[model samples]
Target: MKIHEWQARELFEKYNIPVPRGYLCRNADEVRKAAADIAKPVVVKAQILVAGRGKAGGVKHASSPDEALSIAQDMIGATIKGIKVTSVLVVEAIKPEKELYIGFTIDRAMRAVTLIASSEGGVDLEVLAKTEPEKIYRKNIDPMVGLHPYEAREAAYSIGLSDKSANDFTSICLKIFEIFNSVDADLAESNPLAVRFDGSLVALDSRITLDDNAVFRHREYYQVDEELSPLEMEAHAADLAFVQLDGDIGIIGNGAGLVMATIDVVAHFGGKPANFLDMGGGSSVESVYRAVKICLEQKSLKALFVNILGGITKCDDVANGLVRALKESQLKIPITVRMVGTNEEEGRKILSENGIWYLDSMETAAEAVVKSAYSRN
Candidate 1:
């Protein structure tokens, strides 16, 4: 799960990462108070989950308490990418002689920790990857051995630091890696890791994404759960993996592979999927209801594509669950059903007799859903 910047900075401080002194403010008064207490030029940053805050006017610089208050007042209720900025971070500004980027994340392809570093920092890494790929460097780290001191030094040197600074930077990288492992973090990054004129380093910004599966072991992290959406909370509670998308077609399939194939089929048929819902082997009425509710919550949705190839699950059971949901839910959207294998005839009969559209092929269902959704749109 993604935590706010304040929470991420707190975790970074705990891991011995040097960060600027800052105060989390809920209102403009608190922002002024923080700036006055610090008695220095400060940066006012809006705290929100979305990225590109700068472009959205969610970040501003203040040279005095009055300026801080003004910026905070203007930012507090402002919307950044549709998310309201409810809090701000007032941090003492720093003078940087140089800026660098450093981050650690799990590389699923390599099944190992990967370190990303570059001389270019304070900018989105994806933009760098797309525009100047050669400027960035990636190194695979063995979790078993951890980020060794020698390796860290080499990485720092590769990023073009001096002898002393390289060693110091490497030490910092090692500490950050230790934090990632200890906290079970999925990803952690410090953008524009600054080298001050006095030869010290500090994190200008921090981001941390915790492993949701490991949250059970970190109760403290769970306490900061105000950022979760209702659908996300429901998906977590049901232990049914789901992802919400932006489209008009809701899809439910039995297998992950089948779900992906269904998505491809819908796209090919000129439709976009609203969500990825997998009922899996549990074709029970409760599971179906849960899946249907998830789909129904998508206000843009106009049709559902229920494609199930029942192996261990009976087709009639799937049909019955769908019928039961239709009876219970006040959903107005149409559903195009596609059932195959394990008493398929009964499933077809059940849907057909009820006047629910049942297609014998996935392609037909996709075409029908696309047409239905387009007409509604």
Candidate 2:
């Protein structure tokens, strides 16, 4: 689960990290009031989950309260990266003498929480890792021992800070790591941690991604909102694992591994998958129908691929769901199905009777669906 920048900043404050005076504004009036309260030049930032907001014109400078109101009005209903912006963060725009990137996240390869720092900041860290690898400094903390103050200082100095500035930076790093552990977060990032003229550090931006598996431990922080898309909400309501993607072919499978493999297969055949929908074990006809209906509702979907290697979920049951859905719905997109386990013969017979075909080979089915989707396009 991800929180907006304003929420992340609140968390930072709780951890004793300094952040600019800011207000979470839901409307133009609130933005104007916040700008007046700050009594300084403010930055108006659209609060959306996706990145590249600055490049997408979601961040603007407001020199006066009226300007802040105007900026807020412009951003409130604007769409960025396909997500509608409903709120904006109005904060004092600090003029940083220097900018640095500092973050703590799980390094899957190292199997430890890694602290990353860089002299260069306010840009995509992935690009920096590829282009100027030397600029990126990394320290893998022993989870058993946790991050020590000395290690945090080492990271700070590695980024070329010294003296009082180094100490301040070290404190900020330690606090960020503390926040990461306390929140059971997968990632806690402060991009472009700004250094003011007085050498004080402030978090200009923050991002926190909590581990969904640990939500039960942090119930107070878990609140459902309109941040999720409609398809995501539907999947959540059905208790199915699903994620939307940017493509034309909708994918459905019985397990996570199977669904991922199906996506790879589709991509291998020069096809892009629209979504990942896992029906999970012991999937019923209703669940399958709902999944299919959700996929069919997606605009620009040329085809759907259902690959099920059933162990607990019977193949015939899946076939029954698909047959019923096709009969009841007016889905124009083509569908390719491959079922290979648990009463396969009965499943094939049912599909054949319903004027639908089943494939024995995943590779062949993937190729057929890719061709079918392209032909329609």
Candidate 1 TM-score to native:
0.89
CA lDDT, every prediction? Answer: 0.84, 0.90
Q: How many residue pairs clash in each candidate?
A: 0, 0
lDDT of 1: 0.84
Per-residue lDDT of candidate 1, residues 1-377 (tens digit): 77788988988788778899999999999999999999999999999987788888988899999999999999999878777789999999998999899899999999899999888888889999999999898999987777878777777888888866676688789888877887789988889899888777899899888898898888787643444467856875775557777777889888788888899899998898988888778477677767777767777777888998888767888888788777777668878888898888988888887788777788888888888878864
Q: lDDT tens string, model 2, 94-150?
A: 999999999999989889999999989888999999999999999999999999999
RMSD of 2: 2.9
Q: After the best TM-score superposition of candidate 2, give how far the Cα of residue 167 lies from its true spot, in angstroms.
A: 1.7
Report the number of the highest-lDDT candidate: 2
- Which regions of candidate 2 deviate over 4 angstroms? 220-229, 243-250, 263-275, 299-304, 330-336, 352-355, 367-377
lDDT of residue 294 for candidate 2? 77
Candidate 1 weakest lDDT stretch, 10 residues: 223-232
